[model samples]
Target chain A: MEFKKYSKTLFFGATLAVLAGCGGNDAVTQDDVNASTDGQVQPVITSDGSNGDSAVNGEQLGQEAQNLQDQASSAIAALPEVETVYFDFDTSVIRDDSREVLDLHVAYLNANPAQNVVLEGHADERGTREYNNALGERRGNAVKNYFMVQGVSADRIEVISYGEEKPAVIGHNNAAWSKNRRVEIKY
Target chain B: MPFKKWIKAAAFTLLCVTQQAVADLTIEITQGNDRATPVAVVPFAWLGQSPLPEDVAQIVSDDLERSGLIRPLSRSDMLSLPSQKSEIYFRDWSLLKQDYLLIGQVRPSVSPGVLTIQFELYDVVRQTRVLGEVISGKVSELRSRAHYISDKVFEHLTGIEGAFSTRLAYVTMRKDEAGQNKYELKVADADGRREKSILTTYKPILSPSWSPDAQHLAYVSFETGRPGIFIQNVYSGKRRQLTAFKGLNGAPSWSPDGEKLAVVLSKDGNPELYVIDLNTYKMKRLTKHYAIDTEPEWSPDGERIMFTSSRSGGPQIYQLDLVSGETERLTFEGNYNARARFSPDGTEIYFVHQKDGIFHIAAQELANNRLRILTQTPLDESPSVSPNGSMLIYATQEGSRGYLGAVSVNGQIRYRLPSQRADVREPAWSPFLTN
Candidate 1:
């Protein structure tokens, strides 16, 4: 299911605890990605049309527009093939392989300011329905928090947990459960 | 209670006999007492012009047999069917090795449509009468009269209040003609008969909780394309939405006094337990933790609330005192423990505990912190206790279908109540009815 952008006060305490325990402090940010890839990185730009000192010649304006289009196209091209992240049973901790996919999503969100994404979280049907709903919400928030740390705007990301109500696959085996416990990035 | 008015004003006429094609829930006693006291329930004498509408003695016998505490003898095994103390011969029952004997008579009263029942219980070996009583009811209430007699006899023999008249509320999921799953909330007699669909929806419905007065049921429904908590009058079918927050609104449990509901809401932030006043519709947040905290259940005395929280890294049961505002963890043995409920008397707590990768229903004594697993089947969840605290009903898997099962508090006896076509789950036992 898709959800519209909703501004919520994301709880960073859990994110901080998760980061502290996982000890990877090397999460890539928008600035790092820009510095490493773009040769002519422009100055910080806000959501509005122009940055400070808006007066500029038409040639310079056209040149800046070209640069922005090139950066956005390259960012979209850099996205990973996977769009969904899988978690361990009963735990919302993101795995190493899933982090790469989330990084791609973060970069894409940064390049396209008008675009918003929804994180759909799900769980296996092994626990009580209400408890699984809470677990699914935690998993969705885990992904949302990761995007926040990677320089994605919190308002651009909405989350909703379907819990065990909706399964990606219809089976009771471990193979089905592994696929069901996932967060899909829908843009 | 106001529920009587609802039943009287119900719009949908109950098709009790017309829908008998789908078999009613039948109980299969999986285990029982090894040395159950052998008893004989003699067929009652009918003094009316026509045969009695019901066999009161037979109904009582079935009640006792379902309890698993006593084994009633077959009617064919009895040498004589006695209806009075003077007609019962002590040597006859003693020869059958019966420990207890029950005899009764039903006669039409002078008042039109009224019937009077007289019954007595005797100790066969001791040759002493244990109980004698007379009950009056209309002809249509014969089944209820039988259950009342069973309750009285049970209390006299076992010292535990009988739960024969209580009811069970559960959810059933089935596929509609369009091949889409349809969920329904149903209530049935404790013996697993006379089921009525209280609510039906195309979307999923979870967690059916009975009000303390047994008049209303509060559950989470996804009818509006989003989850919301709704309270509906079981008889009248009148329903009102309670919560429809943006993120999560689920797990509604009524307080002891029925003035408030403990619910889980995520509107403020992460999933947290909140107590909402029924009169004002105002909410008071109970937990401020970042980790998931939900599934709050009230204690019988209204002084404490037990809930499930993952604040300690993984989900576990926790108790919060409303008066003192002090919170303490209650589970440590398992890595996962959720959906905890307090026994009616408040002496013990039942919950779903995961052990060795399989989920089972478990009980923990509040006095010494001792825990005992009660179910042998894996994937058991939603354990609800009877009003008298004698039996617990929960949901478990039988092959691929979900079914409801009951187990005694001592874990000595067990029974299964499987649905005919749908998957039955999320059973909530109603409190003892005073009416």
Candidate 2:
């Protein structure tokens, strides 16, 4: 079941790439790749003017764009999803499941130094508002400390906690609460 | 003279027995001298294109009435429905026996999609404007602004600040199609309106406690498959994990001073209370009992603590002197009593008590050793007294769902605030706001 879930995620990612290529405007943002690559990086700038052999240049531009897209897709496929970190009720301690996810996150941070990531901490609805805020912060710091220990630069990671104010699920049951108490990695 | 002495002695003996019976029966008068004040809230008038917002006046009426301190007069019975101060006729309100009048108008502001709400409060007897304020927000905030105005009028007349601007945090649970349960942490206005979910999960979330500053929350989350305490900030969305011990880490209580937190952890085998300093991140054990000692609450003065323990076989309330480290049993009236909270004045303690096969709220006078049952509910638990000690909020099971309810400290009035969609539990009333 877990292997099927991963394969489905990869398939969905490839479909998203193909859809983006068909769309006319293709402007790559900083989030596209790590900026500090030590190889010969060729900038692919497309001509926006309507005059010079428009179809030919458009085809060439599409080919170059496809090459970058393929690179990004492969990179994403190689990366593991960091959703395994689970927190105990009102606790910030890293559990066994968290260790697996943290290992992937640490590897990603080590490979990309120019990339900055934000760790957002959350809590399930149970306690008072202020206490949950503190609890969320503690969870974020726990992840940050783990990455620092794994040779990632502490300055590259930021932590924030949204305590019981933003829930992923609206249901008021155990299933929803479990999903709400999580830490997300945003790059 | 001998015959007269004999008659006096017999009468005195009879009086003593009657007093003893009254003490044993425990009839508590929860109501105070201040009855729910009567006020008239006229529907808001529309000045421009849009129709007046739906039920703005009704929302304000319900908010005040549910607080058990105000009785909003019906609009149908009003002599005149006024939308502004000039349209109000004090003589008509006075004739209708209404003490106060609220009038408001919603007009289009310079900014598009924004509405300006101008409101006024009039003293019917004095024939003067008691309060007037203008607020600007999106049309969606109209109901919230109305509640704020009602709170102001209540405070102006009663000299006690209303909790209209305060928010309530609670947990809701529901079962899925496969029978797995989902839980969510929700925040809403004190009146149980405008609920927004903060967290949702399959794991159980318990014992959410707010910090004194109202900026942070500490709760127990079981998402990682074990109970641990976590703290999160509301504004910036930051979270920090405080502890992940083996046995248990639950029931976090913030110190009144906001520098430390008191929580229940069982790292040393038995559940006990520990205080963690926020700055240093160091924990100090407060209790060393082999029995379960949990639910620590700091006193208003921050001099001592009160908590629930089973040191004497059955669960009972105990007080710990911070200076002398001496513990004393506080409850002696019932075999099952827990979750004790000190009154804001520190003169009495309120806790859940089970007597005669029924669970209810009991208050003990610290000075006179007098105990009184304040609730008549069958299963009352987690009693949290208001800052003024005039009311207490607790959670109990209604059919199959948990519902939050409030009772006057005197035990005269009782009302339940149940959610229409989900089961609600674990309500913590915020302290009195300064302004």
Candidate 3:
């Protein structure tokens, strides 16, 4: 647990310095993505993994860090790209693909503690209105719980359930229902 | 608690109100009893006016025909216009297979702006007069007086008090010229006439519940960008926000005595049920469960509350004994059941039930636990019982637009109320208005 905490902070600090290096421009440029992979994040993971070891032995450590960096970067990059997580009818269990997306959100929140996020939960127009309200709350809470487990601050996270009142798509078909049953991550 | 509270209550005065009185609902009986007793309603003789403001007899005939208990004959089929009992020949009605006949006359009363309405209901087969009455009201109240006569005649015929005089509240939504959705909370007569908008907002309005006295309506409004419960006086246009809790201030239902409200609030944490006293604004939490528990409705006697809860792995109706605080599950036959309300007689509970992926209105008898599906339409919801306990009105979809539909308690009769331009939903049948 201690090593995990140290590595988390180290990763966050390196991410911030890289972010500052590309300051005054908040948009995610191609250069920013390449820099995150090839320059700042990769070197720190190798140096941090090797500690006081000799430079000759750094190659083995660098190779190991490269694998870890690639996995983490890919997962993190996939987060903001996926704005919504869909759920099965009447169920709130997060899917496996959603776990990776939430992990990216957790890393972003850990890196920027001052930021806040709101998880908007929705459902298809089925059953009763009040029951759907409760169902939407359960879905939003499921996402909120996953965020907390990923080390996101509970206070910075808020949840609102629109229930079945607001539909992402206006239709009565199964396609609309599947799209409507979701939790939207809003920052 | 303070004088400032009354000032805060007046904030709703700024809301926009629009009413449309141009058209009334055209009755189309989708189904009825094959053995329904045939009846005839002749055009009333108009006196002391260039023309009658409303077709009083037509309104009465439509009300009776829509009840599913009686069939009214077409005006062209009437051999003679009879505004009095002396002009009626019982043999003519018998030839038309009419078991009953109704005749009326409208005239200017001595009291200015008032009209005198006299109507007679007769049993043609028995060759006897069932009942008669003279109603005095403003000229503008012609439709209501017609409904009043329908109620009296219905009571004399079926032994069940008529709900024709009551009103219904519902929500209508439409997109404005700006392409933004605009919602209006409207109250119309039981016959869907003279619809008056009580509240209008750009946000969604839902779950309208009527006070027992029929003077106020409690509904959930999202005007403040968050869900909040508001109680509005249907007459004076006065309204006050009952609660604007952080999460889920929804599903407000009036206690039978009108002293408190059962609401669903999530201010504490997860969604749960709570009852709020109207006098003191005090709230008492009712359920303590990890699962979702909401949609609380009071029994007619006010001794118990039926609500929807997923504690048993799926949505089902559960009864909570208010005095003893013991909750017992009431529905087990279906995998999904919700939005249950006790029948006015307290012998059954009507709810939204799902089967074969289609949602319909259903009723469960309290004595034998006999569950009967009452509707065949898709996405039927918000079932509300009439004050007389003979009919139910619920929200349903016709094609892609929302509309209100009514079905007799026995599921023998059905009708739909659809506005030409907007989607109507969430009907709350008002209680009997005692003058």
Candidate 4:
């Protein structure tokens, strides 16, 4: 087997502090492409916005996800080494790279049922603190929902949002904000 | 005794005691009211300690100018120093275009540690004494009394009641000795005097909302692992965590009656609005939408709650009727609007509105739905209206540091309350603080 070094495009230091984590082997796939295509993303709001967006059925999606994971059980083995996932500005929607890291975390969490993990979410300091708190929590909940879909119990995952209060990198520019808006998984 | 105890605890955190008394915030009046009443507040004759511990007249002048409605004559421009009505130089002040004059004498009272303060306001144009008052209080209470004198003088000249007697609660964050960010909850006089630290922690603190009576403060503190809503007495500094649910407990807004607090909690899956009864600890979930409904603020009538909700795909304020269980959209002009609060009279709603990728404090008249952006600066958030509903203080940033800025309700007067070292945000002006 070719042991290719996992690649990443994060401008943040390779020196992220992760709890119960290995060396940065967390494969970041499609992040550079996602960042370049961000200009094409439409504004989330429009007139009569609520009519088109329906509430996500988390439980039903969890069951369907569990069936998919049950069939691909052999492919998942070792826990993912990466512990941090970056998000788009003002959005908690999981990107492709973030989903890849979380999928590996789901494999790690499934292999060890005794293991419990905490998801701490954060946001850039562009918006109001309280709304950012909600945004951060939404990011955490998005990760937690993914874990539950992969057969992890709700109690095993703890979600906390710091809003814009705590920043991994302290600066006002987009470079710092992109790194700041993230979810860090701690085991 | 509680205040004294708090002072003792706060004294060590102070960097320079002398500088803070004179210069804390650099006030820049961006928009001047052409009709602003110009008044000269002559220096008050001090009869207290050898070197007066405080400058009472300067404090009063700062308070008046901070309000944006009054223009204080520069101390140098004063043709002559007058301390009483008998030393009348009305002709000179009139030449300087002063409409009114204020002078006072602060003398030691018969009781030890007490000073009897007297001040007189004269209408220069009318050439008659406008108002006169005498107050006696402990030396430590001199600053608050100076504000009191300004309040009386303000009300006598203008029909509106003065909010100078009020106080402010805000958060200041800076790097501590060990290079870790230290967050402090500080309470100060409206004129930025007697600033004392109520609570100092390494964790982040935000949303300092004062109780209706101004006796307590409810805020979001991250002291214990994660974010939690905490309430602490302003005088005692004793605090208790109101909620520490599993997911999120932030943005605590006290009700009008001071009986319940409207907060954002995410324990029941998504971030929803919840009101917690302060007496019984019972939680009443207000909204159950999958979309984020947070930053709950109660109207003065206590009948409706205005909150920030992304239920419309983006953050826009929505009003919830407490009795009828119905919600109505309040803000339709902006795709991003949050951190909404009410004016004192409940006639207007002030919130941070985003336009052209810049956030400005905007007010919506409840009667006609007229939208008016009240601030000139960018990235302004957390608009806390003054008790009298004249000006609102919000957070703005320059480079990476945050500073507090205030703008009048009419979008005319403006000033920035920037600190020398610390980055300050979340300034909650106290209600009419009656002692």
Candidate 5:
């Protein structure tokens, strides 16, 4: 294992950027094939493996509207408060630690009636994904209910559940799950 | 505690080594491998001047071994290797205690880039040839042709149609150059060969459901910074977005007829079941509940839809009658039984069942409700049954990364298709595919 890592690093000294894309299933280039068999190493892919596996980039296809999200982020950053709330496992009920953050967002929404927020709900990488979506949306709805009870109008808030798909941090332990089961107060 | 920590560390290091050493798909039989029928698959004699791309007989042997019902004898144990009936000595194979013997020879076909494999399967004790055929295809198709032969031999011996000739649709994730998680939707042969990327993005793709026709795949893609259902043609790579609702538009399951999809949409404040017509784009809500109703799948007969709903105070599967609108709760043993799938015959149901906090794939008969856990792995979900209803493939995690695992329907045989680098998930095994 140590020898493989060292060999890979040496071969990819200047091609490290391209090495990442080689992880793709059929996206390996002729250069990657050459590198894999460089030191008389056995070739992995079939000899007839094609090099035409270019993927459809979703960002480039529909980026006319999403390009402004970072600007929206800066606006939220100007508020100087917590913009995320988390939940315990399998439960959507808001916790006490999240109360202060939820209240801060409520106050901001109240002060800026024109500022609309999308509560993007998320869950840890556990359980079935679609069920987690529901689990996630329940958390989002909990936040939406709390915000509305604190005087934010229903029209000013939207909710969506990504379930376990998108993670703020990537890992499979409690440290990551505790942070992943969250609802981001997206602008 | 120290012993447990050491074991965990050892397992982690082993997985890292596996990830580095494996190139494509390496089959791992995890459990219940002791009672398989022992057989022999002699290497096919090759006549080509150049080395062929793949090992044909080894692929056939691997496919049979993956079923966990047939075990191939080691080549070293064979007293003599034979490529034709004239060269075979039945007493030699019987001495090795192999119940069945397979022999084949590959010859370059008259057509350039094509090869013909003539194979024969013999019953050792019976001293007679049971199956024989010749398959010819392009050089790149050697793996698939091997699977076809495996299917034929498996069916003739077991009386069950082999799923080896099918395809698998799955999602793979790896970090791109920018150090961002890039996800890809791909399709490949059942043995994890001939993988073709269908879509790629930095966002996540989930719940890849194959159309009944096996020509298209419907999945939830979060490419636009939001979830939407999209259908892509398997061969052409052309896709069209089916939904762009305000909230969650996920879990697109096709009805038996392939004309409509049972989807979960939160367009109206709460996630609910909706039947969306493919041709007219007409959407009809099927379930109305405030407690998160999602993961709607159509029954094989198309008379009812099974979905997961939290209305019963926990995530459990519920069956909804399409004609009467009456709902019946099917699972009562587990607090979390979701992502339910109907067996092809509609006699049983398979799902993700939580037990002692670890999710495992389970099946329950409809008549007697004899519930049985089919998989032993942890965090197993999205149980996609083979069209033959004999086995299933699901998503499971090892360490921090995910891999696709498979098990026979009876919970006896187990295997996994571990990827070399990608975090593979949501594997939907295609039906018996067309040429």
Candidate 6:
């Protein structure tokens, strides 16, 4: 498990550097590729375990890279365009208005077996910071449990609450706070 | 023509003399009771030494009345307005049921811009002056000087430090012409007077927490297009950005020792509580829960941290001991409880408790595990105890607009300060005044 984790970290570093180098109009500059490899990618690989057998390292790195790519593609394909699920003030119970958005997430999760998503809960600035944080987590868990009941694996869905720390709207009025209390699904 | 010029000068001097006479006089009350100290504030007599810029007597009277502890006997009730304690007759005041009397006069200072206010607080019952002192300040600061005199007199009699000199920091949000939200951080006198905006931004600003020293304020601002923590000095107006991490950087709480700050950061893909050393900017992750862990407030002793975590299947307040690495749940009476703050004595934790579908500020005694609701407001949040732990301030909504409110620690004497300019929220009481 330790070896697998190290290999996966190295693969992620390399892929990030390559992606940075690939964004160009000119024939990929040697400096761009070299900079990506030397300045960015090589450090991460060396830190993970460069003294290990290079052949085994390379094969493991390849397998981890393929798995990450598959996960990325699956996540993209399973993405539901729904941006957020709104809730009433001081409430964690998902409303009818947010039910359609949750349904889309449920369908997306069922269609993509390898994909999992985390729900980020948020609240408006109406209450105290600590109360809003708790309220946010409740909203996130509400969405997570709904997805689990719809046949999505419990292990695939995670819930985290941001509370009133982040708001979609900054208004002090009810209109702003109402829009701010919400849950966003991230894959 | 030369004689006419001298006459014009004489008229100007006469006009100034009357204004000076009206402003130089002041009054001081030396004795009072819990049932509103009744004292007569006589208008000061000008010695005609120099021109005064303000009505010192009225200023002193206003200060005493606003304290809610003293009631200045109306001038209409005064048998006579005497300018000096020697001129006041104890028998006349005794007939009027006045318990005390104040008399003073202002004179020219040695410096050009300064004035010396000599005052005496007299006990009408004893027929003697109980306190006598001369205070000097610039003419421009005459009102503040009067407030200081009131504070001294109140403390001498009541034995409680007067809060007249303190200020309250509150957030005000308003909608602007472009239909966008505007937020302002305002500091006002304890009586909600002399308001001044400390910081104004188009981005949202939340959680304005004052440092223990009262020189700086730490708050969460989205001005950089993300929720980040920024500390700004209230006096110097210099601000330092503490965190702008990629994902989430919100809820910055200062430690009791003022060496570290416990904040919520989500850079590692999940929101968790982390303590950052302000000096080195190094962070030690405190909670590893995949569930959200945020709103970290330090215990008074700095040995433990109280925060909100949803790991127990729902949101609840938990305390984490730094030395033992032990975690204990603190709230179980409600479905949701968060935003806990320790009292000044560290005996109880005050937080927002949601029970019976209404949210209120509730206090839980750590020793007995007893919970008591300290507020009647339906949506009270952000319960911040006073430096002395005598009162708690929080924000609650009335209709659609939010207002800042305060209640005594025993849950009596509740009052709300509703903003006419904008909706108010997130009130942070400053630490006790150093001076």
| Predicted model with the maximum TM-score | 4
Local accuracy of candidate 6 as per-residue lDDT tens digits, B1-435: 211111111110111122121221111222222456787777666665555755677666765654445667877788888878657888999898887788888877889877788888888899988878988888777766766777677676667666555667778787899977788887765545556678999877888888887778888877876567888888888998888664457778889888888887655434567777777766776775534577888998999999886655456899998888787899998877888999987899999888886779999999998999987768788888777566677888776577877765765334456666577888887786665
Those runs of model 1 whose alpha carbons end farther than 4 Å from true positions after fitting are A1-71, A75-84, A99-118, A146-157, A184-187, B1-24, B46-54, B107-114, B138-140
The sequence of per-residue lDDT tens digits that candidate 3 reaches over residues B203-288 is: 88999999999999999998987788999999998999988666688899999999999888766455667788888766677776
lDDT of each: 0.76, 0.63, 0.76, 0.76, 0.76, 0.67
Candidates' interface RMSDs, in order?
A: 16.0, 26.1, 20.7, 17.1, 21.5, 16.3
Query: Which TM-score value belongs to model 4?
Result: 0.85
Candidate 4 per-residue lDDT, tens place, B1-435, comes to: 211111111111112134344434555555555566899999899876776566788878877766656778988899888898888789999999999999999999889888888899999988998798889887677777878888887777677789988888889999988999999998987755667889999999999999999999999999898888899999987988877676678889999999999888765455767787788776676776656778999999999999998866688998988888778899999689898999988999999999987889999998999999987667789999889888888889987788888888887667677787889899999999867
User: Can you tell me which runs of candidate 4 are displaced by over 4 Å?
Assistant: A1-79, B1-26
Q: What is the Å distance of residue B363 in model 6 from its true position?
A: 3.6
- Which candidate number would show the highest DockQ if scored against the true structure? 4
Worst lDDT 10-window in candidate 3 chain B: B6-15
CA RMSD of each candidate after superposition: 12.0, 22.2, 14.5, 12.0, 17.1, 14.4
User: Model 1: which residue pairs collide?
Assistant: none
* CAPRI level of candidate 4: incorrect
What is the TM-score of each candidate's chain B when compared with the real chain B? 0.92, 0.87, 0.94, 0.93, 0.93, 0.81
Instruction: Output the lDDT of residue A101, model 6.
Output: 74
Q: Which ten residues in a row have the lowest lDDT in candidate 6 chain B?
A: B6-15
Which 10-residue span in candidate 2 chain B carries the lowest summed lDDT? B6-15
DockQ score of candidate 4?
Answer: 0.15
Q: What is the TM-score of each candidate against the true structure?
A: 0.81, 0.63, 0.84, 0.85, 0.83, 0.69
Give the Å shift of residue A91 in candidate 4.
2.5
- Among all windows of 10 consecutive residues in model 5 chain A, the one with the lowest summed lDDT is A45-54
Residues B1-435 of candidate 5 have per-residue lDDT tens digits of 211111111111111121122345556766545656778999999988997777788888878877877878977788888999999999998888889999999999888899999999999999999899988988777888889999998898788899899999999999888889989998887877667788999888999999988999999999988888999999998899888776778999999999999888766455677887787766676765545678888998899999897765568888998877678889999788999999999999999999988899999999988889877777899999998888899999988789988888887667778888889999998977866
